[model samples]
Target chain A: MPAVVIGLADDPDQLSQDLQSPYPILPVGALFSASERQHLSDQYTPVEFAAACKPRFLNAVFARYPTVETLLYADPNVLFLHSTQPILDRLRNQTLLLTPYLLQAPGDTGPGKKAWPDEKHLQNIGLYNADFLAFTRSTETTQLLSWWQSRAETRAYIDFCKGLCTDQIWLMHAPVFFGGITIVHDPSWHVALWNLPQRQLHQRETTWQLADNGQPVLFVNMKGLFNPDEGFFPHQTRLNPAKRPDVMALLQAYRQQVAAKELAALTAIRPAYGMKPLLPVVRGWRRTATTALTALNKWVDTIYLPALPR
Target chain B: MTLAFTICSINYLAQARTLGDSLRRTNPDYQYVIGLVDKLSTANLPADLVPDYPMLEVDKIGIPDFQAMCDRYDITELNTAVKPFFIDYFYKNRPEATAVIYFDPDIIVFQPLTELNKALETNSLILTPHTCSPTPDWERPNELHHLNTGVFNLGFIGLRTDKIARAFVDWWKERLVYECRIDLCEGLFVDQHWVNFAPAYYQNVCIDKYLGYNVAYWNLHERQFSQRPDGTWLINETDELRFFHYSGYNPFRPDDISKYQTRYTFSQRSDVKPLFDLYCRELLANANEQYTKYPCVYIKPPTIKRYQRVRKAIKLPINRLISLLQHR
Candidate 1:
């Protein structure tokens, strides 16, 4: 399988040289109309913009490689620990394949239960992880991609209040809208922070398996591994690095690989698109003050101040 | 054998009767039962008001925490929350019932459920999306609303009495025990939102997109109803009008299409006027005026519930502070 990087770049040559990779870099700007690009850039954050570009990227890939039987989209942060042949094999009957965030329900007994991503969280974010998607060249796949593209173009923003979570939540309708969608329950596939509570990683000689079930770790999503500030995806407290030394070691190795790949310099090359002004990060005293004020406001609103009989 | 049922309090008995009457007329072979959330014994209804159909009270079913559920949930929430429990009751008791179908009390079947029966023959569970196509405008009950509520409408759920369907029901029952709420921020809307995971979680789950299956206010964007010379209704001049879910429709407010929808009025959707008119007459004939007077025995007074909610909200911040300090 050939790997392709879909990115928006001012100078493709500079980006290519910075990575020094064999994989071709497909420019995202050329795929859509100027108005569409403008709308996407205006509405979406850089992270959201990248996620929203998935369908268009896949559509472009299919158009480029017409004879390509199967195309799998994995986030740039993903590290493949095993072959993707099992996923591809599923595509023989299934048109579109999606990996759910958690194969097994989170445990209810332990202290981790409170911190673990519950069904509500899954419902909010999405049942299926948007990081990995497999598409076979079929009518159903075409319908899914087109439908996803339209939704991603407009509604791919991180708004949990309105039940929008950047291209992921929309896949909830994929099975209903487009038939032949197989929700791959294979525990090995697309192991990530959300599912880390249930899945225990262990080394078996050369291969890594989930210690509880002994399922091979096909691929691990390395999101937030490189960023110390984020610490394995923001707002996620389930993963305690003090425990799970196996996962820590794997993440450490992934970090070293990312470091070697000049992650700092490459990430510094700002995309020409989605130049929306970022929200200012609240830190230290400001964060504490904001939290306190919000709490106070809620408290005040909740305070029972009933009017006396007039 | 197929068993079709609807859950409703005594207040909605008129609607349930209308639904039962429609099913009897259309799909006569299928056994229709009214799953009453309100107690018939407590209401002490006259013989005239008692429905012709077999009525199963919620208490009859051995729900472990039945009283607790009634205390927590409102009328609508409690009615919807016990849906899976009814299904489970039938699954265990009704041995002859091969397929079990649930419809909201507010729905009326038009044609025979031939396609549905056929679908249920193979599929473990059959679900109908709230709308097959996109809503034309950002109207009330639009895509975002559907997303907030649920992708599939729980007004109609068809289940084949298989291991998978039983498992699905069991799983659904567990969730609806406490979590079957209309809380959008919590990503729940009664029993409906949880079924969004049905097709994904369970096997042989069919998302039946048949235009005729679940015609309602939300899906009126895609479906238009018209009666043929032969007296059978057709949706979009193609598929037979299998059923119409009169969700948010009130008989008293006859002119309004549905209170929940602002997308279309009777004037705009004259094509669907006859259907609503028919439903209104059917409901009235079934003693709608008398039934609406009966209050559900389960639901508590709103003032007490409101006070409790306010007290919880007041405690929330203080509780959070205490937990934070303890953790530190």
Candidate 2:
């Protein structure tokens, strides 16, 4: 039987609105209520979602499944990246797959020149593409869940933080600490909307034309683009106030084009203003070389090296 | 002859250059081996200056260290020593010889390379790095990560023209020729690090010895060296030194070496410590006439407000950063 997988997320109601993927949906409840978060409040926040949602949801999965291998765990913001075959190809062997995000370069002001010294908030928290993740049934995931359930019940949030969220904090050392399986930052598998993941989006600028041939979008993460009134201006994207009206209107239209599956109309949407070159991916080799490299690299160091090298 | 290193040391004494002269003066034949890569074509060459020694211009082939890889010739801007026409001529006519050594102009060769050729007896692609011990932190030398790669100093390399070595050089050339950019990959812009895994890619690559052949400044740790009992200089362990690279701390004011006192300044090998006495013999013998002004000091209005700030900012962090480079 094909494995049943689920992607979990919380903006409280983010997945609830987009609850119409090809897979079944389960909305994780808020870990802490708004009243519990009264001690510290966000000017705007998901202040207490992960603590409330994750363990409750993951525990439900653990109790039902004898092991995690029978199912796949995914992040809510991820959309299909390549045709489903590329993902299914990965499923042939691996138990876990993940994408690594650009950590704040200890001194990286931000991505570009206007990177003011004051804007330097936290050092790069590279694990940020925390949006796309997969879990398989194994001693590692089981152990991970065991540790997580206990921690989530306590430490709601700590400050060097954008906001206290549970799912990301639990993974502080998943790759190095866990027994090791297959975790990937496969550009073909999933991409976050802004930052380093922005490179993947640029690679796909011409991909919409190619996607019309029944290709799987694999999973495209539009996590940064869901501001309700703002619609979709890309997460962390900055625009001049004068030109903001046109850019926002075009992006909104692009989101509609994506939703409507009007591939040609979406192609007309212009890219955001930025100078970093779109990272290139060698095509045709995606199914063979790209996927193989990503999976192999994960096992060689983190999981196996400890047991063998020592 | 089995092999010889031909350096393209153009206008080396000029501030516009690097250790090309020092590279040649490593031993007796160092200068004789170097030919300046110049603006003129073979047709434009003066009748007496036969192209006996090879010089390269473009960011390709034998010319591995081109303008694209470096930001400066000792902090000078790009496109400084470009000989635009040299590549068109050499690429078309240069012979595929047995071996070639392209040394940096600033490099001072202390001894003849008899053993360097013997090491290349296998006919494999040969290359050298400054320090290959991968260390996590060069600042904290004791840390396990201070493994510095001496690859960036292109002062000396031994290459033979058989199939495997040619294939390797061609691969390095392709990288520097096409994708060379100083801004890429944390400013390790020079495509030298490719040497690290070039052996894996090409069948015949070899990471030459770490200490004796391609020595650089980074390797000196807690142990100091002194003239040995056998008349050879000794560091902590061995004194069988093949080459001593005077990489940094040049005597810019000539008198810095005369009094044995360190000064805050920048000048060529002729002005620094005894590091380049042999190479700069001609220049220094006459230094009393041309560059007679001694005790010259280079003081800049401090970038930081206080002396403590210098230690707090540049000194410690830069040291840590060096250790980090070595670690990887």
Best by lDDT: 1
Question: Where does model 2 exceed 4 Å of error?
Answer: A1-310, B2-11, B14-96, B134-152, B184-188, B222-224, B229-231, B253-328
How much does each candidate deviate from the true structure in C-alpha RMSD? 4.5, 18.2
Tens digit per residue, CA lDDT, model 2, A1-89: 44454524333342235335565554343333555333223311232333334555665675666654534445444445345555556
RMSD versus native structure for model 1:
4.5
Give candidate 1's TM-score: 0.87
Candidate 1 C-alpha lDDT tens digits along B1-328? 9999999999999999999999989999999999999888889999999899999999999998788988888888988999999999999999899999999999999888898999999999999998887667888987778777788998999999999999889888888888887878768889898887786676688889999988899988888777889988898899998899999889899999888989998999999898888999999999999998998889787632235566667667766664454334
Error of 1 at A55 (Å): 2.6
Please give, for residues A17-63, the per-residue lDDT of candidate 1 as tens digits.
Answer: 43556666777767877787777887777767877888888888998
Residue A148 displacement in candidate 1 (angstroms): 2.4
DockQ of each: 0.27, 0.02
Clashing pairs in 1: none
C-alpha DockQ for predicted model 2 = 0.02
User: Chain B of candidate 1 versus the native chain B: what TM-score?
Assistant: 0.93
